[model samples]
Target: MFLNTILNSIIQIIFFAALPFIWWLLSARKRIPFTQWIGLKPWKDRSTHLGVWIAGISAAFTAVGLALLFAFQGTETAVSVFSGRGIQAVPAVAVYAVLNTSFPEELLFRGFLLKRLQAQFGFVAANITQSLLFGLLHGALFLGTAGVGKTVLLVLFTAAIAWFMGYINEQKADGSILPSWIIHAVSNLVSGLCAAYGVL
Candidate 1:
């Protein structure tokens, strides 16, 4: 299980981290700026600053809610999904995961994909599409168990969360991914801790 988890994590990291570069190369034919595809910009507005705090708090509550929901419902699969690894080892892996999982995943799903798709398709369409893809990415975790339904629910829940965060990132109109990053990191950290301690 540990080996499988580690391998899965590595693959996920590589896949997401390479996404921007892959998309950039493909979209380069159309002359789209790399920054636009990567969602890079300067943070010049106060709203972006405010968003950091708001999103952070929202992430905290969201983590708590997810933990409680999984715990009360006796969903062992959901609780154990991301737990086996030791927290002390997280830092070493986190440096890579932060870039690969957090930043690039957000950049690909929320930044490049969501923004570009939204321009071509409306807001609702973009949100739903990206959210579904986000959910599908976790399909492997739900294999061979009744956890599939719970996994889908969790993914949909996360999708809704991502939609809101994506909106904030877009509205900020600045280069700062700080708000969303903070929210994502905190939410994951809290969720992992809770699950590890069996509090979830």
Candidate 2:
């Protein structure tokens, strides 16, 4: 099971990282930077984008705090960690989670998927659709380990967070995904630390 999981993750990472380039090549589109196409463009309105980024960070934390308060009665959700494994694995996992998991997920869901969906459907539909997919993907991954109820809650929480990211990403005129990526990477890093310390 562990090997299968690892292999699956590796496959997903490779697939996501390569998908945009593959599409570009096959479509024979005009020369455009991949980052822009993937919604990683430079910020146009610096102050406005920064303001929205700050507001997004605040809102995300507030929502998470409130959800935890109400759902768990102000208690920390118990987190499972590597039991017999040494602390050596913590840093490695933390780096991989932030770099591989967080970045790629943002690129795929918030960047590629969200933009494509927006072009097809409106912004709101795209945001919601991507968020739902993000949530279900995560929830399904941990279903066996976290069980039904916790996984359901996790799915809801992740979906909410994904929506926040999508909203922030679209707030920019160029649809920059940098702010959302920053937030996600930091969040994943912190979560990884908490898990390492068994404080999640």
The TM-scores, one per candidate, come to: 0.68, 0.74
The TM-score obtained by model 1 is: 0.68
Residue 126 local lDDT, model 2: 98
Q: Tell me the tens digit of each residue's lDDT in model 2 across 94-150.
A: 554556566778889988889889989999999999999999997787677666887
Off by over 4 Å in 2: 1-12, 48-94
For model 2, what is the alpha-carbon lDDT of residue 169?
Answer: 77
Whole-model alpha-carbon lDDT for candidate 2 = 0.68
In order, candidate lDDTs are 0.60, 0.68
**Clashes per prediction?**
1, 0
